[model samples]
Target: MSDSDEKPEHQKENGEINGEEEIRLKPFQPWYSVQIKGASKNGEVVMFQITTVKLEQCKEEVEVDRQYEDFEWLQHCLNIVPNVKGVIFPPLPDRPIVSAAEAEAKSRKQLGTASKNIKGDEFHKDCRKLEKYLQGIVRHEAIGKCEALSNFLTKKEPPVRAKLKKGILSNLSRAVDGVRKGGHKDIDEMFQKERDLANDMQKIAKETSLNFDTMVNSLCRISMACNHLSTALCLGMSAEDNGASAIINKLQVEFAKSIDHYGYAVDVCTANDENTLGFHLDLYSRYWLSCKEMLFERTCALVQFDNASKTLEKAKPLKKPMAEAAKEDAEKELNAISEVAKKEITKFHQQRTLDFQKSLILYAEAKVKAARDVYALLAKDVSTIKQMDVEFD
Candidate 1:
């Protein structure tokens, strides 16, 4: 992870691309790995254990304490320009959602009632997602170099979250603006095709995410049911004290052991799907929407330029100068928006391919491991059952 000018997405020294248009890369690409080691609760706030895994600026590891709000502050402070638009801002990982039982468990620890420290599944999962969010943005050429990021990593004090209120007037103005900028006839076929693909990809990602979520939930229920069955199998032990009862008890114990192991395999499958396929699916769904918003900003720029052109045509002789200036300003803004959108869109596609490939590979590996685990558990139980001594009539 070097903060070098050379990035994989950059074009070659020859500057000639294969028939397609060449994209100019930013002069610097900051690369670093960040991790959320664990978390600590301070009153109502949860502080994350932030560790810098690799970076040139900080040759030694830098560890700091931060919270979810601190991350939100960093993300919102990310400025590609004075006004941030047409850039694909990485989405924040969703806030951790815990059930009532998990909440009570955490509360006990916070209140110094619990004897041991233990984290829920959601805690581990959220930390991983947050890690990805930090790593994703910090590797981007423009965003990664932000002073805000450096301060977040190196500084001991957490960032103060900026308060931006959304009032009714602001919401109304935004909706009106969206309507004003909604439709524009794109003259370029490349961009038109890209926009169409984005629309389709967003829908597909959302559907796939929902399906995986349903699948994981079903697996969890099955695991719980099997666990209950495993426990019930042990209840027959105290019924009677006879040879037949003893034999029945042995069989029940073996069966219970097998069922319990199978439940673990089911639990493994749920974790695998959630971390790999399910997590990425939901992530991509958000990013696809983000990219679409970038294009929409470009479209908004187009609309402004078009409106300014029309206004210039209708202006009186004395007002013509002001109108012409407006057109020039609009044109400049449009060109800038187009460049930013192009850069971000190109980055999005490349990153999407890499992410999907990695997710699929990990998902396949998890499946194999889960299957092998269940096989070992069941086979062991079968062997034990065969060796049991039982008297028959």
Candidate 2:
């Protein structure tokens, strides 16, 4: 169609015709209005109730009660979303530190020797944690823009399970089918070995996850301790502390950078390990099941074919040719089925081999990157310490 001819006609002033105006739709922009309504506590654990209002014309309001773990889960959920790949979320608070005295008190409380309600001082502390968490997330561009985070804030529903892309297993699917038909004991043995290896990797991933969490919390604790030291130095030295305060301040700044670096790493490397482990475990489970089922089919086909062959062999020469014919037909069909099953078994094994190879490469890369990050952080810390020592001298 010609450009002008295809245009819709519109009447304008002075009897002139003009093309129709194009209509454009704006994308949805969502904002949240949130408040920490209150908190509930058991002996050891506490949950904060949050109230959220979505500030659109609809003005939707949602109330949810969550503990610290729930907040961690929310952040973890956001990390896996492919749509928000480059998004960086704020760090969650470390676990509360309970001194020996506090631990004794908690133990007594748990044993019913003390009251169950949270102490006023402790409640206020927990409240502050909640406040900081809310402030951090709401100001984050990535977390703030996330639909899952929005749902977390505004709704009381079960978390949506993340679906792995079809491509994740496309390479392994056919090979898995082959493994089923051939009923090869060798393939099954290899699969078992690989599955064991995957399990071991999963265990390592979990340990690394815990260690990274500890690293973040440790950095936070160290940062706070340094701040306190700086305050003490300034207070004790009064105005003539030489250069103690300046040195302390410099040290604190360095620690702060280290904390920031580790925090970002937690969101990137730690979160990535969590996601990859889940995907690998799931894929392994499917592989195991497929191999087991295919082996069973192949075994059954072989048994049936054997029985048919034996029946045909025992039949008399000419007395029952009809019976003999039926036996031959049964043998042929079962033998064909057995052959098909064998082919499938081989195909699945090939695909599975490729899949495992790819998985190994991913795991290796992740491990190397994580190691490098730790090395870099430690090196920076050492350099900062040397500088601090010179200032002290």
Of candidate 2, the 10-residue stretch with the lowest lDDT total is 14-23
> Which consecutive 10 residues in model 1 have the weakest lDDT in total?
110-119
Distance from true location, Cα of 172 in model 1, Å:
5.0
**Candidate 1 residue runs with Cα over 4 Å from true position:** 1-27, 98-121, 167-176
Task: Highest lDDT: give the candidate number.
Answer: 1
Candidate 1 lDDT tens digits, 135-198: 8877777678667888898788877777756699999987787677655677667777777788
Show model 2 residue runs off by greater than 4 Å: 1-267, 270-282, 310-326, 389-393
Top TM-score: which candidate number? 1
Cα TM-score per model: 0.83, 0.34
Clashing residue pairs found in predicted model 1: none
* Candidate 2: tens digits of C-alpha lDDT, residues 1-393: 676764544223323412222112332344777777777776566767888777764787888876666676776776665534222233355555335467557544433344343322345445555565565566544456577677678667646544534484785875675555434332235444534554455465446555644554344344444445545544444343357766665666566566555555544554454345433444444444534544444445445555666766776777467666766776665555445544444555575577657766786788689778867986887787776664464
